[model samples]
Target: MKVVLASASPARLSVLRAAGLDPAVEVADLDEEALLDGATGATPAAKVTMLASAKATTIARRIADTVPEAIVIGCDSMLHIDGELVGKPGTPEQAAERWKAMAGGRGELVTGHAVLRTADGGIDRAVEGHAVTGVRFAEPDPAELGAYIATGEPLVVAGAFTLDGLGGWFVEGIDGDPSNVIGISLPLTRKLLAAVGVRVTDLWESD
Candidate 1:
């Protein structure tokens, strides 16, 4: 079966490729802020799951006729700290502030994954799930924090940090799947696909 990634995240793409799957990319055009505002969920997991399902369903509906046998996957991530949901900081100053607040503290990184199988202009199967990881940050000095912000990597990622990039050094530890912290969980994705009666290995690209 053909695999489609309904996201524009390079980290997610890299993860899939590293797992030997070649997926076609068709980013969903979503008003994320508006969706978040309208979402009704009691926890981070529920919210992210809703968003991921929306993304997958939107893309699947659009491409179902063209790629009827495709398995579309959508993912979203957020950091929950101090009873708040945190997304991309969008600025160096905000990133720096986030780092300061996160230093020596622990937060939950939740990533939602949704899989939709398209068939004959509709969805044949679907499943949505989420993975959460507890992350502890190492206390960084002001200079180090400022330097990391200056690198500009944190501004575009959830929680203003990354586990596979420059921000990795400041992450002291993770309580669960590290890949989920990077925006997608390979193992979780595999399980979700299986739940929908699709084997992850079946989506691997031909050699």
Candidate 2:
């Protein structure tokens, strides 16, 4: 079976490649802000999972004919802190403001995963789940934050920080799967694939 990733996040792609699976990228084009705004969900996990499912299903339909007998994976990440859920900061000022409140604090990084098994130009099975990791932040000095913000790393990533890039400098620790904070949760993905009757290792590229 072929493996397809329905996301445009470099972090998510990097995580999958590092884990031995070389999935074909199929970036889903959607108005994410509109979806989130109109979405009805009581919890962060639910909202993220819904978004993941939408992405997966959208791409699954697009490629089901060409990539018959394949597993499609979709993922989305968000940060939950101070009773609010936040995605990418999207701007320097917003990034800086988020970091100001997040510094020396803790937040839950939740990643939603969805897997679809396609057969005969349609989905035969689907599964979805979510993972949450506690991220403990370090207090970077104002100057350090300004420099980091200038790099523009945090502006495009969830939680306005990263675990595998410049933002790592201010991440004190993580309480769960480190990969979850980076973007996708390996363990969760594995289970989701299994739930869809696909073995993750089966999708690994042959050496």
Candidate 3:
């Protein structure tokens, strides 16, 4: 079966590519803020999963006719710290402030995944789940934080940090699937694919 990734995240695409599946990328266009704002009383995991499902559903409809037979994967991530949930900081000052609050603290990085099996121009099956990884942040000195922020790497990543990029310098360690912290979880994705009646290996690119 063909694999389709309904996200624009290079990190997620890289993860899939490294795992042997070359997926087609189709960025999902949605009002993320509106979805989150309307997700009242939902837990962090639920909220992320809901967002993922919405993304998958949106892309599935768009490609139902052109790419009718494929498994569409959608993912969303957020960092939950001290009762607050945060996604991409989106601004240097906000990223800096998020770092200041996250420094030397532990947070849960939750990634939501949605897998949809599209067949005959419609969704034939669906499965959704989430993964949470515990992140241990190292306190960065003022100069280090300032210089890192100047690089602007944190502004576009969840929780204002990254596990495989420059932000790794400030992450002391992680408990659970490291891939999850990178924005997608291989193990979880495999299980989700199976749940949707597709073998994970079937989606791998042939050598």
Clashes of each: 0, 0, 0
Give a tens-digit lDDT track for model 1, residues 117-181.
88887899999999999999999898888889989999999999999999999999999998999
Whole-model alpha-carbon lDDT for candidate 2: 0.92
For candidate 3, the 10 contiguous residues with the lowest summed lDDT are 198-207
Q: Choose 1 or 2, whichever is better by TM-score.
A: 2
Q: Candidates' lDDT values, in order? A: 0.90, 0.92, 0.93
Provide TM-scores for the models. Answer: 0.96, 0.97, 0.98
Show model 3 residue runs off by greater than 4 Å. Answer: 205-207
Q: Write the per-residue lDDT of candidate 3 for residues 1-207, one digit (tens) a residue.
A: 677899999999999999989988998889999999999899999999999999999888888888748889999999999999999998889998899899999999999999998999898899999999999999999999999999988999999999999999999999999999999999999999999987787766341
lDDT of 2 by residue, 1-207 (tens): 788899999999999999998888999898888889887565899889989999999999999888768888999999999999999999999998999889999999999899999999899999999999999999999999999999999999999999999999999999999999999999999998888876777667451
Clashing pairs in 3: none
Of the pair 1 and 2, which is ahead by lDDT? 2
Which of 1 and 3 is ahead in lDDT?
Answer: 3
TM-score of 1: 0.96
Q: Evaluated with lDDT, which candidate comes out highest?
A: 3
